[model samples]
Target chain A: MTTLDATLDHPRGGSAAALLRHATALARRSLIKTARTPEALLDVTLQPVIFLLLFTYLFGGAISGGDRAGYLQFLLPGMLAQSLAMGGIALGQNLNADIEKGVFDRFRSLPVARSAPLVGAVAADIVRYLTVCVVMLGFGMLIGFRVQTGFVPALAAVGLSVAFGLCFCWISVWVGMLVRTPGAVQGLMFLLVFPLSFGSNVFVQTSTLPGWLQWFVHVNPITPLVSTIRGLLIGGPVASHLVVTLAWMAGLLLVFVPLALRGYARRA
Target chain B: MTDLVVRAEGLRKRFGKTQALDGVDLTMRRGTVLAVLGPNGAGKTTAVRVLATLLRPDAGSAFVAGIDVLKEPQRVRRRIGLTGQYASVDEDLTGTQNLVLIGQLLDLRTSDARRRAAELLEWFDLAEAAGRMAKTYSGGMRRRLDLAASLVGHPEVIFLDEPTTGLDPAKREDMWGVVRNQVTQGASVLLTTQYLEEADALADEIVVIDKGRVIAHDSPDGLKRRVGGLTLRVRPAEESRVPDVLRILDAVAAPGTSSSPDTAAGARPGAVSVPVTGDTALDIAVPALRRAGIEVTDLALHLPSLDEVFHSLTEGVPAKELV
Candidate 1:
């Protein structure tokens, strides 16, 4: 029986190192799950490409005054931002599913840091957001969308969207921890993201909307993210929109990170 | 150093209207198994959760390996492993992947984690299926994998909440063997179950809880003794002689002893049983039957089983007498 004791010496390293190790391990598990069930990737892959195709062809002529190229240029960045927002929902759904399956109980019983599972789930989702951006960009270029800025600026645009998506994910994490079912996570996230995506400058300029609606569009969190991507990828006014977008990211983290952690801790 | 590895006193938790745990107390020495046996909704799971630091007790204190559960939960976590009623493994990952992930979470080095995972998979008899996704494994295999995952850190105290709840008899035996192996390896165990036989087989001390309160706590033999002394059964050679045999049994029975005929349809045609108080009753019974011209087909002494003890304890029998 001492053989069992010899096999499990206390894990080496400091507490912080242990936390990082646990987080990475959990992230690796998420990635493996995605790899095994490739269908789960449809949200970040097929969904974005389909959105790019259907929107670019169906609404381009009507919205852009018959100039499909101009509409494609405008729509690509908005679609990328939209896809990033959609990507954030997966984190909540995954967490909710894990909770439903009692997987988090195993995580809770471990000696790892309390926040590691939540943090690891968010980290793994960043990869999903990056995948969606690449797929959206590649699909958009296949038709007629061109990046007006240089390659570095276009990469920076995708990077910025990924960062924003990560920040937005805390809302989903919080919702996931608070809800009892995976289906509830999906429903709640849709209620939140649907209007934010449509009411903003994703398909058409906010100016086209009624005055009252324009006020909401201008202040919507997605608006700054869409505008920032538009400036970086297709060249537009950026400084003010960038600041608002950063502020929103910071505000979201400040509010939702603690909420998510607390919800996770409170859940037995 | 204190030999008691787990101690919980007056732990109370209420889930809205249902008091899941009401003033539950548990204690286990190092390298011993303390089995908490109870029916459904009897709060066995709740007590284990509080001790494992998965749930905070509404009142009272618990210490695991000398760490206060509520105040030093992290330290307690480091010294304990828990396998809940449900198989809590990522179904998408392979068995080896599951164990390795837990190992890594416990902060083992990458290579060490991999090695440990392989060793555990082999020990759990999952080496052949180690590369397959957990979703593909059968129920018994999934449970084994879950148990293997908990051992990745070699926890000093393990909480197994109904470890063999849904397992077949053979699989249950396998799980019992694994638990015994853990105890022999010097890890204290606190297990919860509804199976009295499971308690009899695995527990060093059994705590029987019902309706969120401990009804009795004793060793397997000690519990059986509470139901009283050896039972004497006498089967007559002729079915018509049952009355004569019962009369002789009653006459020979000591004062205060209860004697009854086996009237159930399935019972042998002429069978009678009597609770014999002292060892001398058996000696008196056999000679009394023969002297009365009663021929006997069978006569023997029987010890009360845990099943009878469990039934009497949970069936609203007074707890003070049994304790």
Candidate 2:
């Protein structure tokens, strides 16, 4: 019979290395899973192309005073931003499914960083964000949206939107942990992203909205993200939204990372 | 350096209205498989989770692999691998991919992860279906994959929470072999199982827990010895002759021993068993039953099973044990 021992080296140092390894492993697995099954990124890829076709021809004359070029120019940034926001729901759905299937329990029992699963998931969604941006840009150019601010600023716009989308992914992780089923995640995320997408200027100009509604548009984080992308793509002095967008992204990450980590730590 | 690999002192945890763990104390040694046997919600899973560092105890402490789970949870996590009751591998990925993912999480290089994944797939006999999605695999196959994933890191201490609840007998034996393979490697295991024979076959030490407390803990043989030396159970073919059989058994069996009468008048009808005083006395009692005009259908003289011991220990305890 085995007896209890009193001595064994139980190293507790190097938590940063542990966390990094966990995050990278999570990201690699997610990327491979996406590669093996492309359905995860299909919505992010196809939605932007479809929106580019449906909106420019259908609403350009009515919304932009018959100036098709101006409508195409404004629609590209909003569509790209909306696509990233919509894809943020994927993280919540994936997490909810894992929780239901008891995969999270397996990870919970392991000796890794508590926040690794959520952090790894958030890290992987950055790749999804990049895929959506490239798809949106490629399709935007096919229809007639030109980037007047050159390649560097356009890349920066993509980076900012990706950052915002990643910050929102943490919020979804918390929501995912609260819900018991994957379908509930879809329902709640749709309710959240729809208002955040439409209440801002995704399809129409915020100036046309009533004064009370315009206040919400101005404060919405997605509003600044859309405006930042617009300023970067159209070459204008719109520095305030860019600064506010970065600040919001940083602030949300700061709050949600610890909150989501706490949620994960408490799980059975 | 005694071979103790697991030790806990007064482990306690509560979830609002329910006390999941009501101060459990347990111990196990190296190369030993200790079975924590309890009904559902008896803090079996909660105790494992505390030792695994997945859940913190509200009070008291536990030490796994010589590391305090509360003071140094990461160290405990490093030495332990846990396979939960359900299939926890990613179903969207293939069998090989799931093993590789766990290997990578342990910071193994890509080539090393693949090599280990390949080896595990072969060991679990899942190499033939390595490329198939885990979702498409049968329940037994998925459970095997989950077991294989836990071994990727080669942890010294393994916690298996009901490893064969939903498996066929053949598959359950296969899982038993996997566990034996671990023990052969000198790895310590804390297994929670409802299957009494599973505990008999695999456990070096058996801990019977009820209502979040360890009621009795000893070797499987030692626990059986608690009830008595031997039990003489007989089932006669004719229902009417059962009373004659019991009367003969009472006459031949030793005096002052507890005997369940086979009378249909009181309590359960036609269900009676009597415990003999000594293991050798059954030799004399068997022949006496044949002369009483009772056709014996089945008769056995053997040690008590874990189920009988459990029933006796929990007989008078409150039925609302989990709450």
Candidate 3:
């Protein structure tokens, strides 16, 4: 067959094969593009490592009262949550750039599934979120942060972190759609994420704060996520935190995914 | 007939207070290139967008490759390729990667996508630059790559909306060649352009739209015939002898046309223009001036051009009035 014949004559997929193939191909391209530009992972790699070093070494002594090494255990889990949360901004930044550059418009003109780019981008972020978690876990070990929960729960902890990251990605997609410029996305995301990161139970236990602040922190979605990761990493029953975190994930998917789909339908 | 790949009737679209497309109509046969010509803000891009399934029209209907665009945009999208006015390729990927990405999106197997990417790269003469990042490509290269990317899915109908807007003349010619190749291969092409010369040189059929409505549609020569008959121009060798050339022009076009002197002397020394009334009649109000007493440099008569037709049609009237 001629190249055109061979290309076009292929079975257009709605079958089981089609779904698997499209997803795998999209993820592969996303990974290849990311691998080609190692700089794309700088935030994913550096954020977790930086937090692990700064919070554990510098402030652990003052905050946890002389058990700085022991504090490593407490800080690593929170850093994982913060790392993945902050890394989610990459989604907004990249989406803004793609939209501005007309890449999304190009995709819209094609017969490809509209969800491919969105799904691919979020799926590719899976690697980024996982990488940050693994790097933090590795460096935490070097800095005297042991995983009291051992191996299986460590993997579960990373899974929870990545899932939370994916949930945040949906929110970021909405932000990316609303804010079409890359610089604007940077400004808006930083402004929104800074308060969410600091005002929650990320750096300290929420109960230590004032009553009103504690209430807000308790309701913060990241608090349940951080608490869940902490429980997973520290060897205890993480049932309630996991349940609450999963509920948040489900809630975000329920609300923001539809908004994202709407924005995507309009923007694309 | 089955040969008509695209048919639109009373297609209308409005954006807020502005009517972007007003009762636009078009028809294109299979294996032919129809160039849609209009000025900026005249809704050429909007028309293409509607046909490409990217936008929904407020009223009317369109069919592309036998599928109703509004009713089944997915099917229309499957049958047609669209190259928007801007370069719409993935800027972060290499040229080959961009093409392959579309191929994969079209559901090609991995090896098949790569092979198709290579083939398109070779066809567009981008093989050497295929591995380079698209961001580093020049405007012309990016445009060609965009066109190539559009073709990766083997779309039977292609909509090129102002595909050569920003390119230099040489690159524009290259794009014309690409469009020619597509039509020659039996792909129905609806090309939008503001450049009358591009339409004249490339279009098998021309549809001229002003504001949002199509004003004229025909072959280039046929459309040129409607505005005016023709013109005969005479040019004197010296500026001092311009009056002499005007006298000759007056002898020709003056009898029933107009005898305004200011209009007569307004003729440039190198040119005195007069309308061609018929095939062989030289009805000059004044005799050949150079033969009588004036020395002239050059004289000629020719049919009206698409440019003149466009200017006469669109000059003083706003596009909305035409609508």
Give candidates' CA RMSD values in order.
Answer: 4.7, 4.3, 4.7
Q: What residue pairs clash in candidate 3, if any at all?
A: B234-B272, B251-B284, B251-B285, B251-B286, B252-B284
Q: Using lDDT as the measure, what is the rank order of every candidate, best first?
A: 1, 2, 3
- Candidate 1's TM-score: 0.88
Pick by lDDT: which candidate is best? 1
Q: Each model's TM-score, in the order given? A: 0.88, 0.86, 0.86
Q: Cα deviation of A238 in candidate 3 (Å)?
A: 1.3
Q: Please state the error at residue A17 of candidate 2 in Å.
A: 4.2
State the lDDT of candidate 2 residue by residue for B1-323, as single tens digits.
Answer: 77678899999899998788898999999888999987787889989988888788899888887778899876676678889888798988889889988887666677998999999899999999999999899999999999898888888999999999999999999999999999999798899988667887899998988778898898877766565545677777877877777776775454566556544234345544676665566667677776766677777765555556677777776978623
Residue-level lDDT tens digits of model 1 in B1-323? 65888888998899989988878888888899999988888899889888888899899999898789999787788789999999998999999999988888877778999999999999999999999999999999999999998889889999999999999999999999999999999898999988777887899998988777887888876765665646778888887888887777786564677578865346655689887765688678878887888888888876554456557665665666433
DockQ of 2: 0.51
Which candidate tops DockQ?
1
Docking class of 2: medium
- Stretches of model 1 off by over 4 angstroms after superposition: A1-13, B228-311, B314-323
- Angstrom error of the Cα, residue B266, model 2: value is 15
